[model samples]
Target: MTARERQRWAVLGVAAITASIVATRSLVVTDRDRVDRFVDAVSGEVTPGRIDAAMRYLDPDRQPVEITAYEATEAYGPGEREALRQRVRERLRAAAGMRFRVLRKSVTMGARSASVSMQLYSSEGAPSAEYVLRKHGDDWLVETARLR
Candidate 1:
């Protein structure tokens, strides 16, 4: 190849490698980002009958094992997914207009699971909660949440 042509190919190769590196970095999902996204979904606005955003972050097979204010301690099984959604809907409706803020947070990551402990501030109250998430395929789903 001519000298100019060889240099052009080398530049193209470097460009390709740079593009791939950028794409790979963009695709890397950090555990902290997952927790942040979960908080965003849970704290998102919910319409009367639509809670799709929050539901997307939750595992359909599991529900909050314990909720202090609700006095619910028993975990809902897979069959109760709909029921859990309904409860969340009701709570979301009741909490309408209340702004939720994450006061502090800590994330612990495992091979296939993660735990997020956070203190939340809302107009109604300040509560501390821990959420357990399990990685499924390329997504992380909230397996259980303990809210106090």
Candidate 2:
């Protein structure tokens, strides 16, 4: 090919690579942003409906471990999970409007899965704790939730 034609091709190739990177970056959700969404979905409201809504973010096939130090792991079906949540619904509702004080948050992308870790305040008090999440398709599913 002519020198001018080769140069034009090189420029086109560089433009294509740069465009690809920008597109991929836009699709990537930062660790902090994902954790913030999790906190908001879980702690924003404390009602039966809201609790169920939060649980929807969990993976039904895998055990979605949720504990508050006082309670035990919750890994049940839709009905059973709601029943278990009912046990703590009353107290949690009292702590509504809970705001999370994020201490640390991170996400690790893997070959076929990704994990999210975050430390934040519990509704009960200021005790910060870390939680785990797993990527299911394009959305992150809660693998474990530790909140009061």
The numbered model that scores best in TM-score is 1
lDDT of 2: 0.61
Model 2 spans > 4 angstroms off: 1-36, 43-53, 59-71, 77-79, 84-91, 112-117, 121-124
Residues 1-148 of candidate 2 have per-residue lDDT tens digits of: 9999999999999999999999999998875566567666664445566666665666445545455544555454444555555655655666666665566656566544445555666555654444566665556666565543
Itemize residue pairs with steric clashes in candidate 1. Answer: none
In order, candidate lDDTs are 0.72, 0.61
Candidate 1 lDDT over residue span 1-148, tens digit each? 9999999999999999999999999999887677678767765344542367667776567433333444566456677777777776776677775666778888888988888888888767887888888787667887777788
What are the TM-scores, per candidate, against the unseen true structure?
0.74, 0.51
Model 1 spans > 4 angstroms off: 1-5, 28-36, 44-50, 60-70
Worst 10 residues of 1 by lDDT: 62-71
